[model samples]
Target: MEVGSTRSWDELLPDALGLIFKNLPLQELLTVVPTVCKSWGKAVMGPYCWQEIDIEEWSNRSEPGSVERMLRMLIARSNGSIHKLCVSGLQNEPVFSLIAENARSLRILCLPQSNMSDSIVEKIAGSLSMITFLDLSYCYKISARSLEAIGKNCKLLEGLRRNMHPLIMEERLSQDNEEAHAIATTMPNLKRLETAYLRYINTIGALEIIHSCPQLEYLDLRGCWQVKLDGEYLKDKFPKLKVLGPYVVDRYERNNDYEDWSDFSDSLYDYESSDDENRFGELEFRFYQQFNEDATNGWPPSP
Candidate 1:
């Protein structure tokens, strides 16, 4: 007899609804889930739903001002409890400073391709003393100075990734040993490190990290074209550490055509920034629509 009775979505328990929202990415929580109704709107407005703020997917769409405003709103909603943050593409210093000012409890920070500088890294070190994991992959502006800042300040850091900086790869191997030296000199607590595609980094830098980072457990040297390795030396030097090998290709097989190199570089830079000029409104809607289909299938939507 009660089969036809209907309950509104607003009638659902807040805790139950929050569990569903928690599984969603941060962008979806802020832009989509809160828009459903007043009950859900209030539910998602809480700090628990904003603990991890990852904007790498939407980095292409964010402007300096937009990112600042978005962070302000999210930080207020988070109430200073943010622990993990990942952002890419947005390069404004003030916005980054704002993050350091608010998320004091951050533990895992990923800033791949974000155009962050050494000074900014120092500021982060100065602000958050508890950061344990950091990702600086493709952050071309960061150098050994930034590493020094982190090593000196963030004593708890256990994992670090500094893969593929575009500018550094073009320079000579000897010119950029600052990063290796800085790590050896400061971060004695580091356990995991990734240095993929750093073409200039050689055996000396690798050896420095191996000797300096006493707690090293994982090391990724893939695509480090200049690092020559001897199995026996590596085994003897780092008996407890596990290491991934560098990219393998015959050096003599390389193409040295100047015009070809220039063309490749131009194409690479163009593809990297092609999405920067676009907006996120339509993309957000599409992401939301695709979720249900992908969720049921237990797979991500096609890119």
Candidate 2:
């Protein structure tokens, strides 16, 4: 109320500062905000700011091994109170184990494009009992076995995204509906299921899921060329359910937001065919190259 009054931002409480810091990017939170003042630094270092850690953007642009190190640091800062975590490009086993050990309150976990395997899924199922939403899109290594384990363990789960790349002609012929059956039998509580771009599932699998998961409110079957839906049947049986029909090439051609063929522009997707045994090797090479370039130029500026 005075003409010459001065306000000190550093005097703000840690909880208030944390609410403000939550809006900032992970990179800025880690590097810029902390250096402003002692109070800001303390707030950034506390568990409040690390409750919902989303490193997807930073992980995509950062150097190799940097994402893992940053995850370790941030998870430690959270002090086991992390509730939602979204990460990409993870290939390490120990990091999954670390999350299982520490993040007991985790409810939403997104690991899109990560190299997670079925064994790892089994290992972490026990720790994921509290999870409500999970995203495993583009995780080709995961199978029906892992989905069974997840459904059994994560009783509270209501959302699942298990999207995949469209299968080649030969692979599609031999593909089974085991995954759909697993989801249908075990994950009855799911309300939202996204199985986009999965060429393996047919009408049988789709019917199985629709019949089993009676609570489903939203179902996405885009790019599933084999699954043919009867519109009248769906409307009569499940009037409240909303579904996205199979992919129509011309429909998504003008829509950039659709992820059906979004990754095809990347070099990695160029080798995504079943015959490409060295795909991971190439990915590692690219990661290492990027890291070397960043190190030489002093990227991230030591924070």
The best candidate by lDDT is 2
TM-score of each: 0.72, 0.79
- In candidate 1, stretches whose alpha carbon ends up further than 4 angstroms from where it belongs are 1-19, 25-28, 61-65, 165-168, 172-174, 249-303
Task: Give every collision pair in model 2.
Answer: 223-247
Model 2 per-residue lDDT tens digits across residues 212-295: 998887777756777888867887898767666463322211111122321223332211133332332332111212234543
What is candidate 1's lDDT per residue for 1-303, written digit by digit as tens? 289899877988876776678788766787888788888888799876667776656654666567657767877777787887776665788777877887588888777667688888887778867888887777778788998998888888888877763234656455766787888888888887767666667789888888888888767665575677775666676666666546322110121121122122211111112242132112111121212454323311111
> lDDT of all the models against the reference?
0.66, 0.74
Best by TM-score: 2
